[model samples]
Target: MNMDLTHVLDVAQLTDVGKKRDHNEDSVASDVSSGLLVLADGMGGYQAGEVASKMAVLTIMAEMKERLAGSSSGKIDVASGMQMESTLLRDAVAKANAGIYHASRTQPQCAGMGTTLVVALFTNDRVLVGHVGDSRMYRLRGDAFCQITLDHSLLQEQIRAGLITPEQARFSNHRNLVTRALGVDSVVELELHEHDVEAGDIYLMCSDGLSDLVEDDDIYLALRTLNANLTFAARHLVEMANDNGGYDNISVILARPRQPYSAGRHWRHRILGWLK
Candidate 1:
């Protein structure tokens, strides 16, 4: 996690309050210095959602920076058997959950508050993604764009059980009905995924606001058209979501991996792929 940020990855981020919401309840952060990225979508009344989302983002960023500091890299988490980067990302999210949960329990305004989280960490040649609730991560490789993180939502479950189809679920009223969320309970289970990084790979982490309103094809189109201008890509995504009703807070973080300087880096990735 402590790699030099010298032309390693291209990163851009954007967030919007949306037309329907009076205040933005989503938070996003990208720290190329620490090779960390995060996004959170919050739900609650009395502005607790905003508080929860901000708290989640700040806590996770701080924890990740601290944990990835020095040369620890990371160690295998016994329960999950994941590599160091994965374990560290898991621990960072867990730490954020603890902080948010503690505040919700003690603060009257924060009672029953929670947020959905999606975090990604970049290492030398891999990406570790961890998420809770419906916040998602998608990877666009060449002409292919597909979601990488499975959602923990009732709608997703119904689709998996064949009770509903993807098209049906899309228009279903359960778009915001997440089955799992941070700070909702004392403990939460996170979904973790890993992928080998390749040059020109584009990763998108976003809240449900964009996914619920904008079609996947549209997202792909924006990224494909504005791939070179990440700033425009991020803005266009939020703009597209708003045009489609923008029923909730919108947030996005885009990252593209860069080629390594040393030829040995390619060999290293090949070795990692072989191990996988």
Candidate 2:
């Protein structure tokens, strides 16, 4: 696809303090130029929660921006499609993890504080999704909205083990106990997924706030019917979460793939149609 004619991105972000939380601890950033959307949820017992999240968002994106600034977008011949796109996303996640861990060690108050990270990178007709911790990425296609990344949490493990039903785990005390996070260790394992994009597709990268307060079915239903407007989806998702008894900070970053008809392509098609 030509860079000019390929699907470009339109992004919207929204955050909330929720019904119980005094301050929002989640952070979201979108780089329309690079087609990058990142969301981080901080975990800490005290004020460090906000601190960790702030550091996480700033460090991760700063590193990613620096890397992209010097990037060559790879060769057009060998690297194309999902393979090249996924590699770029993986490298950025790795860099973010390393940066978070380094800050944890260097900063005193930041110790024992970590964050869940979810990133979505759009390249051509594919979206590369990567995550560490309970944060998530979702894609809406046609009439269905499905989670693209798996959650890294004890509750999820129990559900997988069949030790607890998903309904039971929804209210389980272990729901907040994340098994993986960006700054919790020197190395973090990331779950990566790639999906084919459609012209009307919508992508959501969100913190745990939405998942914790709102039900999965509700979220899916909302996204399934959500307008193509990215801002509408972002704002309404947070509002619904707040109304449903939000006890935590909520941050949502939304990006939609936009397919534009090029004048040349349109005229060519019209001419061909008339000739036929």
Candidate 3:
């Protein structure tokens, strides 16, 4: 994708151990220059969860960065109607999964460690969201807030099969029992979705720790109140989750579009203008 046609991103991220968790098992990474955001929520024994989450984030970031360096040509390759950006996003996730899975198998300490993942890559006119397990991506366009990624958990399957209602699934014991996760096996499937982005649109990528405890309406209110300040909005979301009996580690990433990329504009000036 042509960098000149894309929107500059304003990003803020925060992670917390939460009120009840003894250790944080979540990891987050953001590459503002490339408009990349990643979040992972891990599960395992002792410190393995933290290790797995970090590995997933680092692997994805490094792989994506390396591949994106060659994509400056701004040529969009199409395959079965999927854009080049989408293909790149998919390949990046697959590469991360391979690295994580290999480590889990070879390292005894990392045995059984797996993590939920959510990744957002912003191109010139669209954002590609790729996810596995239950970590999510939400978008706030104007006054409307909606979840853009679906969870790959048993509760979600049950809800889809009409075995339970949305209200019942909320209180279900299988909320955290994800049917898909990275590093759990040699390969994993990721659900990818694309959305057109606007200059005023705000995207939120978070772990289940925050979503499990906080109501969507409350989260929307928080975003609406502090949308103008990404840092404050991110910190407030973590605080709110802890206040509402944070039963797990919480992580949040906020990204907002600042301005469309213009070749004639100096990059430094544009960044300074957004910070102002």
Candidate 4:
């Protein structure tokens, strides 16, 4: 199955610090060769958070480029593209953690700073996701949507153990507290997930700033309402969160998957696919 991807891939991203916060401490990076899109929301004392977030993004991207570029791993057959991507993504995150830890040790100002990471890697027929902390990845398929990754957070742990009801966790004082993140220690734990991808599927990578304030249903509506224009959708989505009471820094990335085959097919067929 040599699935050809759309020649033109479009991605949209937007970030805003809520009304209460002055600075947006989240950062995003896209590595097309490995098909990775990373989002990190930093948390720590004072300005250390922003420093950690920036370092995490840069470190991951740099490591990925260093490892994948001019390396034998990327020289594999097209048939093994999926496996190559998987390995690269895993290695990149580990390298990022190491770099963040090293930086924390070298700089007293950023010592102990940490950040949550959510990364999505797209392949010909699927998308692979890796995450730690509370940032999230979402997929929209046809008329339905689902969260393809889990949150490694204190609130989620409590909810899972039945120690706190979902409602309580939503408004809990410890809701923003995360259980896992990079740069806090020498090593970090990560979660990786995968899903079948299709043309017309829409993907969203965001931090807790957006997810905490905006509900899933609202996201679905926004995508439908925006007609999938990159700039319009990204800005409006951020604006929605800001209007809803900007409590924290908001970040968003919206991407729509297109099929190579569809480009040469009958225009009406493509239109009918949506109607169906």
**Which candidate leads in lDDT?**
1
Report lDDT per candidate.
0.86, 0.75, 0.85, 0.76
TM-score of 2: 0.84
Candidate topping TM-score: 1
Q: What's model 3's overall lDDT?
A: 0.85
TM-scores, each model vs. reference = 0.91, 0.84, 0.90, 0.84
Give stretches of model 4 more than 4 Å off: 1-6, 32-34, 70-82, 260-276
- Give the Å error, residue 164, model 2: 1.5
| lDDT (tens digit, per residue) of candidate 1 on 34-140 | 66899999888689988889988999898878777744444566787867667767777788889889989999999989999999988757788889999999999
lDDT of 3 by residue, 130-222 (tens): 999999999998899999988999999998999999899889888999999998988899898878888878999999989998899999999
Worst 10 residues of 1 by lDDT: 260-269
lDDT string, candidate 4, 138-165, tens digits: 8777778888777888889988999998
Per-residue CA lDDT of model 2 for 108-208, tens digit only, reads 87677788888876654566678889898887777787888878988888889999998898878778888998777888887887677787787888888
Winner on lDDT (1 vs 4): 1
TM-score of 4: 0.84
Question: At residue 121, what lDDT does model 4 achieve?
Answer: 61
Candidate 3's error at 13, in angstroms? 0.3
